[model samples]
Target: MAYSFPEEVLEHVFSFLRSDRDRNAVSLVCWSWYEIERWCRRRVFIGNCYAVSPEIVIRRFPKVRAVEMKGKPHFADFNLVPEGWGGYVQPWIRAMAASYPSLEEIRLKRMVVTDESLDLIARSFKHFKVLVLSSCEGFTTDGLASIAANCSNDSVARLRFSRTSNNVSTTKLLNLREIDLRESEVEDLSGHWLSHFPHNCTSLVSLNMSCLGSEVNFPALERLVGRCPNLRTLQLNRAVPLEKLPNLLHRAPQLVEFGTGAYSAEIRPDIYSNVAEAFSVCKQLRGLSGFWDVVPAYLPAMYSACAGITSLDLIYAAIQSPDLVKIISLCPHLQCLWVLDYIEDAGLEALAASCKDLQELRVFPSDPFEAEDNVALTEQGLVSVSEGCPKLQSVLYFCRQMSNAALITIARNRPEMVRFRLCIIEPQAPDYLTLEPLDTGFGAIVENCKELRRLSMSGLLTDRVFEYIGKHAKKLEMLSIAFAGDSDMGLHHVLSGCDSLRKLEIRDCPFGDKALLANAAKLETMRSLWMSSCLVSYGACKLLAQKMPRLNVEVIDERGHPNSRPENCPVEKLYIYRTVAGRRVDMPDFIWTMDKNAGSPEVL
Candidate 1:
């Protein structure tokens, strides 16, 4: 006789479990646990929006309060995906509005969001608190104004009460809390949206409008910041000049993370003192970012707040190695750093010496298309950081040249690396020292790093590197490949292995139908597979779609008529994913949806 936990006891136990993976595992114990877990689940994450229909989601979890959904593939950021490649949030928002009225948070990435959808979201969820749209597009400032004006339902009730009684105060009517729009491409119609927020609304805790290209109304912004006492994170755009920063900082002295505007003001004594005094009072500041059009003279004004900063982002500053070294020496407690390769090896060495607690580092290429190794950054800079920062677990380094010996040493130094993305500027670049493929170097990375999860490969790679990855990268979840791999055998090695691989993106690789068809069943276990400029034929895509009714195999070809292409002709782009939603209806002319019942692919 097996004993079962009481329903209330099970619910209470499930409430303590936060990880989506753990909750999913718990729900699979039995039918009883499934029902119990379903009822208790409050937040749900949909990695791919098309993986499951919103109707299925509503049926599975009836009381969800927060939802996080991703739309397009990661390569969409590089303009590889077409305009109407179809990852719209309208359908999901409409369904959730009808079902989950109490939803408090909605986080979207790489998705299409129109002004109508924004207006709907602002008006639908009465208790909405957080809205994060990262790397999203197809929206304007008019849509933002809609959100600012009607985010909270209490505003209406407060308005009615204030009209009825002259003594009643409507200072704290709005309940909206956070609006994070990082790296989103929003059309700058106007910056007057800040004025739409209810006067004296004190609920905002985090507001990031740094991606906006237009200037915001300064008076409205100052008043809003002054009233929101709990605001902890504020990221301004480049339009907000450096001189106005001191005023905003004075208003929000409790900010924990701050992204400044253009740091290029006149080197006047009064301006410098005002900026220094404002930063001195921000005792709780821990993260600093944004310095667009930076003037080296104004850099010293921020030195007072550098001691406590654990995360520093100088990717946009374009400051030279000398100024970078001066700032890096001051941030002794720095843990995460994002900077351009303008820092050079000397600056990185200085960072390694000063910031011993660094955990993550990202070095972006200021001039990616330059054929020459002009920036003076190489594998040595990363090797230096690996030697100094013992706790380093992640790195994204973009360099022109690398050596097998340097990578092996770095891997040996940082065995705890979880995400390693090395993008050699030139495609299929070989090792500079020996002029050989980068197999041994990347092979050393997977073999040594036991916790490697996300990997982006570059440089000249062959089938041998894939063999190494298939054997050692047991926990790898996401892989990005471009202009590498020798043959279909390379793709076969990865598909046959990598049990936890959830997202696989490949472009300009030699893989084709054989590897994909042989590992057809593996696609159902993963989230998605995106391959473009490969050798995958239309016939192979159709067969895969027919064999697996649960999967959505889409062919995206913008060349010409979809029906004119032959069965043996290679597809321009193939997007395959496991989907319970059957088929998406928003696909444009270029996208051809492969149906199980149909003999050939059909354009919707």
Candidate 2:
């Protein structure tokens, strides 16, 4: 017990240690001390400990239960080499497999892993409970069959084979509670996999295969509903359409949560008639997200479906206040709501009057976020929310309109309130050019949001704000501050009090301690630090490397985002976000690109 930290202390400590300086310290502790450390460390990606070999990693601390390896694919300016899949990982994994006997879950993302690697893994992973092979294009059904043959029936519960070329046997996929064969070419994918699920996944739940094409059909899930009486959550990729969703949920009886994302392709107006019809059949539906297109109309049927939901999201469907009021009033159990578009004040007021059970809400106001919204919020929005949801806990993504008076009401009324995720474009404040020193309205955040745990600040935060931030958010674990300048001393206050801080995101903000960063001479507690477009000197990068030697730093060059522009190219910018993960979540763009030249290897 001498060196052993308490479970709570270990949890708190592990949760906040974001930098390599902090992680290495956890790894350095002796075997007995490392056990407690391992519990907290499991939340992070396992393959990231690159500085330590698999053999050494096991020798150092041997109780790893779950391992997730981000399969390294060969990147040549984004043309992934088929042969490069899981090329170097076989040996490293063989080494890792030789050590851990208690491994439970394994997820290989965008796997460059081949048949040979999967063969070795099947033979080796004796205790693997879940196996996810995402984008493992090189694999065939033989490798998948091998995994099924090797894995004990009912032991391997969840299998996600996305974009894989496996010609799987129907009977081989039994005992699975969830099977996501999305974007796959699995020829025999049908109801054969259902016999084992619901029964195999007796305690199992949640199925997500929104983009499985026609390989997996809604009718097939009818067999799944018959077996797994407890199945509650389902996410379909426009396959079942919306109208069929309710019938599917009704068959399961235990179904509750359902959601589908936006549609971009050209379609007729009655495209989501299925969505409206589906809600009608679900007698016990709970969490729901409504979808409607360009034309605005009243959905009386949707209002009826909103009766018992605790969390609701509507796709800008409600044209008038009365329609939404009917929907909110029916949902007496409603707690959380997210709206991508704003409804009029009448709708807000109507919602406040009815949904007394509402607690947390996110509304992207009609007008763009500016200082005026702050005052307007207190009088119009905040008053309505306070009058209705007295037990409100969190309100995120609010603009600069969140004033001191509004902040005071929230603190006084919602005592359990802890987080206030905000983005204020103070530089764009109407009177920002003529503002006096003491006239800035930011001080209210520190004064009222007393127990703030997470703070995301953007748009020219002053030096004084940091002090208030560190003081108010005393239990802060994640702090993200975005700026648009060269040097701003706003970080000093955070450095003073946020000893428990875990993830720090400094965007477009600059500081002078470019050298002290290396003094992070291994700043161990900080794990996920993001510095984007900041006037961060190269010296600071070097310092970060020195301080946290095991850091997987991402230094984004904004200039690289523009290649097609001006006279010849036409478009001014070819943005990474637009073409990458930003435009669509399905395609997560390459976050960090390799700088490998020809004749060199990919993974370093």
Clash total of candidate 2: 30
Candidate 2 local lDDT, 44-153, one digit each (tens): 35432232346655654566655655433212112322233122445556775677655555665554445676566666655555556544445554554455454334
Question: Which residue segments of model 1 deviate by more than 4 Å?
Answer: 1-3, 151-174
TM-score of predicted structure 1: 0.96
Runs of candidate 2 exceeding 4 Å displacement = 1-64, 67-102, 106-175, 178-204, 210-216, 260-284, 290-299, 302-305, 315-322, 364-379, 398-415, 424-427, 430-441, 484-487, 510-523, 543-604
Best by TM-score: 1
Model 1, residue 438: what's the lDDT? 94
Q: Write the per-residue lDDT of candidate 1 for residues 213-273, one digit (tens) a residue.
A: 9989999999999989999999999999999999999999999999999999877999988
lDDT of each: 0.91, 0.49
lDDT of model number 2:
0.49
RMSD, every candidate, angstroms: 2.9, 10.0
Estimated TM-score per prediction?
0.96, 0.63
